[model samples]
Target: MSKIVYFFCFFFCFGIAQAQDDLLKELDSDSIAKSQITAAAFKGLQICTMQSTKLASKGEWYFLVAHRFGDLTEGFDNFFGFDNALTKIGGLYGVTNWLTVGLSRHTLNKNYELTAKYKLANQEEQGFPVTIVGYNTMDINTKLSTDEFPELKGTDRMAFSTQLLISRKITTGFSMEIVPIYIHKNLYEPLSEEVDNFLLAGGGRYKISKRISINAEYALRLNANDSSFYHNPATIGLDIETGGHIFQLVFSNSQAMNDVSYFTNANGISDGKGIYFGFNLYRVF
Candidate 1:
C-alpha cells in the first residue's frame, strides 16, 4: 500500500536526486562532505526547494501509516453515520532534475486502489510555473454479498483518473499548485437513478511557512445528474515536513485520499455538511 496522504509530496522529494552529482561537485569544492550534504539534503524537506540535479548513486524511499475516520451521514440522536478507515504505504524516486516517479496504495472502506504520479514541470520558466501530470486507478476488490455475486467469477471494472497540477512559487518558502483532473469509470450504476461515469475537478496546495502548508481543492461534476461521482468535492489540509519524512494532516469532505476517489468521487453533498473528521499521516523517503 504505497499511496498515502498526498502522493505529490513524496514525488517532490525525488527532484533533489536528479541534481546530486553537480551539487556534489560544486559543494565538495567548497569543503562539504558527501554524507553530510546528503544528510542535510534529506533533512531539508522542511523547506520546499530542490537539493540536486542528477540520479546520484543513492536515491530515496519512504513508507506511510495512515488513519482516516469520517461519516457522510452524521447525527447524534439518530446517529446513522457511515465510517471509513484507511491504511497505506507510499514512496517516490528521482529520475532527473524536476522529474520524478511515484507509487502508492490505499485501503479504505473496503476498497483497494493504486496510484502513480510523474512530475512533468517543477522547475520551469515557460507556460506554467510548476506543472505535474499524473494518474491513478482503483479496483473494487471488496467482498460482495451473495445476492450481488452469487458465484462471483469475473473481475469488476476499475476507476481511472488523471490530473494536471499547475503551481507557482509565491515567495521564499511558500508555493501553491492548482490541479485540474478527469476521471472515468468502466461501469457506474445508482440504486435510485443513473449516474455519470466521469468526473472533472480542480484543487490546490499552499505553503503557509517554512515547515507548514495549506491545501484546498474542489471538484465539479460535468454530468448534471451523476450519482456515481460527487456533486462537489473540496479538501483542506496542512503539510508538515519532518527531516527525512513529510507528514500531512488533512480534512476533506471526501474520505478517499488518493486520486481515484479523492479527486473524482467526492460529491460533498449533505449541504457541504457531509463529514466532520480528519485524514492523518504521510511522508517521503
Candidate 2:
C-alpha cells in the first residue's frame, strides 16, 4: 500500500513538473510587469494550519496532501502517533485570477469539505497596506450514524464557516495576517446548546533564507463554553520550497484540519504534552 501511494505521488509530480515550467514562465512575465503591486506575502497557500492570502493563478491547479498524527505524548508505544495518522487529500482550481475553489476528504470523522476563496483586494507598494480575501467552507460529516443519534437528519451532519483574511507584508522578509471568522454547526455537541461560534485567528511568517521560512498561527475561540473540554488551536511550522513543490513540517495542538473543526473542535491541550506532529505537501500544475 505504501509503495502504491509513493508510485502515485511520483507519477503525477514528475509528469506535472515539466508542464508547470511553461506555465510558470508565462506567469512570471505577467507578474513582473506589475510594478506597483506588492509581491506575495506568503510562499505557500497556507501558513501553518490556516489559509494564507495566496491564491492559485487563473487556470492553475493545485494538489494537496495533509497528515496529522496522533498524540505525540503517547510516546514510542504509539510510535509518536504514526500508527494513528489521519490523512486528507484534495485539489483546488482557479476559476479566474481572483477566484478559487476546492474539495477535500479527511480520514478523521470521514469528513468532506467544499471550499471557495476569492481575492477582494491587493496590497500596493505605496498605497493600500493590506491584502484582503474572503474564504468559506461547508463540511459534511459522513461518519455520523443513525444508530447513535436515532434522529439524525441530513441537516444535522452539516457545518459551515466563513472568514475574512487580512494580510500585510511588513517587510521584505516578514508578513502577518488576521482573520475574523464565523462558524455554525447544525448539530451542537451534547454539552452546549449554542449553535453559533466566533473566532479570531492570527499568524505570521519570517523568511530565514532563500528556500526556508518559519511560520506560526493560533486561533482563539471567543464563545467557547466554560464546561467544554476543548482547547484553542496553535501551531508552528517550517516551510521548505524545493523548486517544484512546497513541504511544510508542523507541530500543532489540534488534529482536526477541516476549517469548521479546526476553529471550533480542537481537543488537544496547549501544553507540550498534547502536541501532534504533522506535515502538509503541495504540488502545482
Candidate 3:
C-alpha cells in the first residue's frame, strides 16, 4: 500500500510539471504576439481597433471577458454540434497609457489557444504615426493521437499557428498591416489537400466620439479550391466603448478563435452559406 501511494504521488507531480511547462511555452508565444500587436502588424496609432490604447496610464490593470456564439446551418443540426459557443478571457496592464500588454485565452468546444499583444503607438495624444509590434499563438488542443481522440480520426492530424505582424496608423483612426504570415493545419477528411494559405488582411477605426468607434477586417485565401471559399473565415466587428471597457458585436463565417480551430477546423456549409452573429466584451483598469 505504501509503495502504491508513492507511485501515485509521483505520477500526479509529473502531470502537474508537464502542465506548467505547457503554460510557460504559451506565455512566451503571447510575448511575441503582443509585440506584433503594438509595433509589428495589426496595430494603429489610434484606439480604433480592439486592442487597448497606447496612451500611457501608468499603474493600471484591465480585464476583458468575451463570448462568441456558434450557430448551426439550416438542417445540419443532426450532423454537427451547431448550437454551442466559445469564450475568451483576457486582461492587460497600462504601464503608461502609450504602452499596453495583455493576454487572451480562447476556449472552444474541444480546442484551446492563447494570444498575447503589446502596444507601440500613441494615437489619442500622439508623438509618431507608426504602429509597430509582433504577435504569436500556441495551439494546445489542435493535435492528438487518434487512439486518444477517436472523434478526430481520419482528420489531417496536426497542430497550427501564425506569427509576425506590424501595422501603421494611416489616419487618426485608420490603420493597416504589412501582410502577416498565415498558418494552417491540414485537418479535414475529404478535403485534406494542402492549401496556399497566405492571406492579406487590414482594418480601421473611425471614432464617432471619445467612446464610440467602427472597426472591421477582411482576408482572402491566396491559393484554395473553389469550394474552400465557403470557409475562408472573414470577419467584421463593431466597437462600443464606455469608461473602462469595450463591447464588440461581430459577424464572421468562422466560429472558432484558436488559430488551429479557426483555420483548419472549420466545418463548411454543406447546404448553403453559413453566417454567424457574435459579440465580445473587453474590460480594463
Candidate 4:
C-alpha cells in the first residue's frame, strides 16, 4: 500500500511540474511575439505641415481638416486674416497595418491630391533604430484654365511629389524626422526655371504634457532658382490632444496648403512678410 501511494504521489508531482514548464514556455513565446513590434512613435499622421511616421491601424479611418488664414499682418481689416482662409479637407484609410491611402482637396489652388504612404521600417524592436516611410502624392490643378494657356493639355495640370520620411523617437518626450522630397510639375509658370524641384525638410516635436506638444518644421528648397519667388517655409505650432481628436495651431511663413504650393509658390517671406495663422484638426475612427 505504501509503495503504491509513493508512486502515485511521484506521478502527480511530475505532471504538475510539466504543466508549469509548458505554461512558462507559452508565456515566453507570447512575450517574444508581442515584443517584436513597437507602437505610437507619433500620435497623429502629421507632425505639423508635414507627414509623420504615424499611420492608422488596419480598418481605421482618419479625417483631416487644415485651414490657413491669410497673413496676420493684414491686421483688423482682414480680421487677423480670418477672412482670407484657405482650407484643405481630406480623409485617410488604413488598408493594412503599414499602408494608408488618402485624398484631399485644397482651396489654395483648387487642387486635389491622391496620396499613399507605406511603412518601410519601424523603429526599435524590429532591429531598426529609426522608422522609415515612403510617401507619394499626385495632385491635379483643377483651376487651370485654357484661357491662360491656349495649348494646355490635361496632363499639364498634373504634379507629383515623392518623399522618404525618416524619423526617430529620441526619448519619450522628443521626436524628430527628416524628409527628402522630389517634386515634379508637368508645367511651370511662364518663364519659371525648373519643372523638377528638390527639397529637404526637417521637423521635430517635444512633449510638454501628456496631451500637449510643441512642434516645429522647415522645408528648404535646394534647387531654387534666382528668379523663383518662393522662400523656405518654416512653422511653429502646438498640438493639443483631446479624446479622439488632435488640434494643431500654427504660425507659418507660407500661406498655401499643398506641398507644391507651400514649397514652391510661397511669396513675401524675404522681408519678414507673409506670416500666417493656421490650424489642423484630425478626427480618428
Stretches of candidate 1 exceeding 4 Å from the true structure: 1-58, 72-84, 89-105, 125-128, 138-140, 145-147, 150-155, 190-200, 224-229, 267-272
Q: Which ten-residue region of model 2 has the weakest summed lDDT?
A: 14-23
List model 3 lDDT by residue over 98-185, tens digit each.
Answer: 3455555666644544544443332222333344433445455543566766666533443444433345555555555542435655
Candidate 3: regions farther than 4 A off: 1-61, 72-82, 92-105, 118-129, 142-160, 184-196, 225-230, 263-272
Weakest 10 consecutive residues of candidate 1 by summed lDDT: 45-54
After superposition, the stretches of candidate 4 with alpha carbons farther than 4 Å from their true spots are: 1-35, 190-193
lDDT of candidate 4 over 52-160, digit per residue (tens): 8898889999999999999888789899888999999999999998899999999977999999998766666544467777788999999999998899999999999
What TM-score against the true fold does each predicted structure earn?
0.63, 0.86, 0.60, 0.85
| Residue 5 lDDT, candidate 3, scale 0-100 | 39
TM-score-best of 2 and 4: 2
> Which candidate, 2 or 3, has the higher lDDT?
2
C-alpha RMSD of each candidate structure in angstroms: 9.5, 11.9, 13.6, 16.7
* Each model's total of backbone clashes: 16, 0, 36, 0
Candidate 3 accuracy as TM-score:
0.60
Q: Judged by TM-score relative to the true structure, which candidate is superior, 1 or 2?
A: 2
The lDDT for every candidate, in the order shown, is 0.46, 0.85, 0.50, 0.81
Better of 1 and 4 by TM-score: 4
Best by TM-score: 2
